[model samples]
Target: MSSPQASPAASVRADVWLWAARFFKTRSLAKQAIDGGKVQLNDASCKPAKAVSVGDRLRIGRGEERLEVEVLGLSEQRGPAPQAQALYRESEASLAAREAAKAQRKLVGAMAPPMRPDKHARRELRRLKDSM
Candidate 1:
């Protein structure tokens, strides 16, 4: 009988982990962003070569979107979306913040009507009637 294969420990390079977990497209891109000081580990900025282990928290920034996640596991190879999702656990605050931002955006979106000028603003009715 063959013995079951043992799984490897959950650990990966910070950049590779980020890329494999879908935080960035390519490992080099992830490294560049991390080296440029765009990524944080447990709230403090970290280097690209830093090792990431399970339970480590990361704060990643992509444009206006900021995501906070805790490393639940690690994978060196880039995999499918479902497998990638197994790597990290997103923070509750991050989810709430995103939802709040969405709601605020909807409220602001409702402020402006489709047309630039309303009927009331189209003409000064009193002036028009007086001229007539």
Candidate 2:
């Protein structure tokens, strides 16, 4: 007879949730963030292995994006964006803040030049660095 199938998790670790929700690309990165205070649970610092349940609030920060979300569903496996979005609900204030930050960044940042510097420019930079 086939062995009994293992049941799915009702609550998952904080690191796993972050990766599954697409906040961090890898579980290790999620764990690092958890350790470094970039991620919080219910307004308090929590460990990477902390169990997160539905209705619990989370604060996640990555680069320019800062998210305050409430967990709505649980899944251990990562999924597509549409499916992942089902896992949490972002607050209206958080959405507004994110949009405002995006707009401000666009207004303040400059665009890149057409291409990389030529060989002469690279050589000049090398000479300057060596002289220093």
User: Best-fitting candidate, measured by lDDT?
Assistant: 2
Global lDDT of each candidate: 0.81, 0.86
For candidate 1, the per-residue lDDT at 126 reads 58
For residues 6-119, could you state the per-residue lDDT of candidate 1 as single tens digits?
A: 117446779988988888999889999998888999888899878888889999988767789998877777778887888788899998987898888889889967766567
lDDT of 2 at 28: 96
Q: Say which candidate scores most in TM-score.
A: 2
**Candidate 2 lDDT score relative to the true structure:** 0.86
TM-score, each model?
A: 0.73, 0.77
Question: What lDDT score is found at residue 81 in candidate 2?
Answer: 85
lDDT by residue (54-129, candidate 2, tens digit) is: 8899999888799999998786778788877888999999999999999888866656454687999999989999
Clashing pairs for model 2 are none
